[model samples]
Target: MNQAGMISTSVSTTTMISGSHLFNISGHSITKELPAGKCIMSSPFVVGGYQWAIMYYPNGLNSYDQPGIAFTLELQSEGSGVEARLEFCLVDSHGRPSDIHKASSFCEFGYVSCNRGFSGFITHEELEESWYLRNDSFVVKCTVGILDSSVVEASGCGTPGNANDTHQAEHLPPSDLHEQLRKLLESGEGADVEFNVDGQIFSAHRCILAARSPVFHAQFFGPIGEKNFHNIEVEDMEAVVFKVLLQYLYTDVLPDLNEFGSIQIKETSASAIMAQHLLAAADRYSIERLKMICEEKLLGTISIDTVATTLALAEQHGCGRLNEACIEFLSRGGNLKEVMDTDGFGHLMLSCPSMFNLILANINDPNVLRDLVIRFSKTSIKS
Candidate 1:
């Protein structure tokens, strides 16, 4: 906040020009003093589809009466014949551009021509008094116009004399199917099946499950269909996980992580455990979409303790996306040493020794890859 009781900024953001590019030169001060003919130029910055630079004279022109430095926002692109409209100004410490000193001029030049902004930008005495110069520097803002209203792209696929500017309707949320199934699942009016997982029974509609999952369809009504089975015994997953899986089958949306009583979700315990089991169940049920969805959820909540285990699951289930994410996260190299101490990491090494090769292969950058190997070696000795 400034002395005024309102919002504020250090350099005023460009807003006046529309359809034009603006470039700002911050810390625009030259350390070395220059002679009468010398000038310091800023590095080239892109604006309005062209390269640009700001040239500033440190000392005033003694031959002329101008006291401070003169600034020029010029085209830096070589071998380009262009006549560009330029607007330049000095911005105050409080981010207010000086409208009084701002200049608008046309620069016509190529690689050889003298293409720059208007002259006599500001005086030294004026700069010291004005709030524009703060911390021995100021901001020079420039806007270069690119096009007029007529430069739009040509459209119409041979339907002559008709503009045919019809736009497709915006995508609506996937609410209809999700809501209908959720309602059906909750009401249990058409529910025809019950799943008993870990001694907990979850009632679901056989038709709905079959429509959503091919495995369910096969199990309930396939070539060797066990159509008469009312309650099916589900294996290898906790009741809560099975319940959540049923919810996903009913609705396309994943429930909030917070809904599952997740405390410290980033660690190896319950948070990703749900997702891990969901991935396994999705794979078993041949629900490719659900498998990918679970893989993504597991990736987001991964921590040092869970990364190795997640990677192992990713490999086992042929989840290429999650597998890549795990390697990339571990390749940061700083966290590898700590991750190594976890029992999951031990299990990963024993079960899938090739994951180390995968991690090493993904670390293309020499610096981070080196750090990762060094950390792994050190951690291995300690472990």
Candidate 2:
């Protein structure tokens, strides 16, 4: 080799500003009289130039069912995409955070709102029974950490280059293999295999499908190859879902679910519906990466109306993380009762009765379940 080429580079640095605020409930018992969805907020404080406040919901927050005490850190000032990490814990007798109950969360506040906190910071029974609640009062400590990153320019000599003899180096463009593959999938110029899905035919290359999915590989080249190779009949999957599956198999990218409006799940977004169907297809084809992508998308869409159905889906597909998250979401505020009122909740109970034990495990208060069953029975009678 003649000589190595040198190029200057710029480095980035990040600075973190952290501060803690304490909200003390003087008469904790009195605050419990407040209804769910009502909150008492601490005085606004500034940390890293952003104003924030601690919202304390003695009964619960954002719901009519009062299952637990909730706390949320709210950004007082208007800001978009403000990233921060929050830690909420009850202060002990010594003014230090008690390890008994602590919740940590990271959030990127968007334009619509800036609130990130735990709905079940601590269950009512747990808080009343714990030593952290002293003299009929309790103190909640919130630690906020805001990160500020900046790029700092620094000069340095590289490769011990000779100044007298200067040379120009050619730079190569980034690879567009994925784009080319996407184009190939769209064109169907050399498709060797065809799939019949719900009366719709999709053409694809066997080699590309085999490279991406193990199930496809076995079907094309393994023992399953004894069957016809030219035309394959896919079962129980919609034409749209199979098309998206083929697209993912060809290119490593998953298209936005909103692109297609052919199927819509009631009370759920188009993306969520697509993700639900695609997750099942991905699981069937043994496409793990696609399965994970769909899982992550579903995680973001979990809400009171959708959590029950999502939980059922998680149980059916053996998605451990999704299952745990749904259980955790149910344990918060009045979410469980709210979800119980939905049709999906009925379906969940009927389809996955095994999930009851896991749900019971996360619930701190037993009376809530008792009340839920009684209330649900009354609602059933009325219906």
Candidate 3:
């Protein structure tokens, strides 16, 4: 109804819906045990007809430069696009939002950019002293507002008004293939092969092992494949190590170091001992991913008592980065003298005599060189 004697129609107006979710994270100290980039996801919540979740990283996102914890908003449902306003705030002891540590942002959630987060939402030091943290537990409130809008048009004449089209996207759950495989491994269902390791028997499927390891494939299915496929005896690898290797082959997860103990052959952390043996077993089986995991574990647990032996293991296994890192750590002030006095150092000397040259090349301190020469000469004379 207008001055032009024609009717104009408006299709729709903008709408917004908002909701909040609170995450209760207990055992905060235990959560910190997880490595950087590892995260705990909150349960999914629905707001404005879409599902969303929160991702909390106790040790930040990047493996290096972890200044604080990280928090991210994740869109769990697939959709065309969503415009959202997100706010994350810690709940204080009295159940109110903490004023000092609040973060807010307006972001678009789509297939291409489905995740938005803060790297350092709050520093570790600040959080430790803040009242928001209590009893090794904390709560975070996440608020989300979903915005939807349709084109508003001023149309003249009898031209039909255009309507916005919306499609229903299917909701897909996260994959649990690894979990199913782990169940298969645990249940020993349909297992066609058996392995005897150090008097302990393990049952597994030949196809799965063949699929996971090239060595197993050649041993089980190749032209020179084993004539008796039902029973295979593995040598040199411990039963526990073989058990962990099979778990990784099926589940692709690292072993829990707490479940294992030190090898007792040296004065080193339990994790370092387990990782050392796993590294050797990984090399023998040609599992590159497991090898890399063992390497990272060893690198993180390096100490004066373990570095020399670790360096020798790295050299024998051709872990170049680990080899260089060990050399670099040993070259630092006073580390050489301390490491040389340990039993691991004697083993390192005997196993890798040429590594002395590598260590000397990295050392620039004259006093360190003199002490190293004296130590080496004495060890040599003693041997």
By TM-score, the best candidate is: 2
Which pairs of residues collide in model 1? Answer: 12-95
Per-model root-mean-square deviation over C-alphas: 17.8, 10.4, 17.2
Clashes per candidate (backbone, < 3 Å):
1, 0, 0
Query: Compared with the true structure, what per-residue lDDT tens digits does model 2 show for residues 1-383?
Result: 53357545555788789999988888888888888899999999998888999989887876764478888888888788888888998886667665347889877767533678888777766676555667889889999999788885445535544322222222446679989998898898999888889999888888999888888888888974636755578899889999898888877889889996687457657888889889999999899999999998988898887888889999999887687667767876667877877888877777787777667655556777886567545545554
Question: Model 1's lDDT to the true fold?
Answer: 0.66
Cα lDDT, all candidates? 0.66, 0.79, 0.81
Q: Top lDDT: which candidate number?
A: 3
- 126 in model 3: Cα distance from truth in Å? 28
How high is each candidate's TM-score? Answer: 0.49, 0.59, 0.56
Which has the higher TM-score value, candidate number 1 or candidate number 2? 2
lDDT of 1 by residue, 113-174 (tens): 25566556666545554445566666766667643222333332322233233221123444
Candidate 3 clashes between residue pairs 3 or more apart in a chain or in different chains: none
Instruction: Tell how far residue 248 is off in model 3, in angstroms.
Output: 0.4
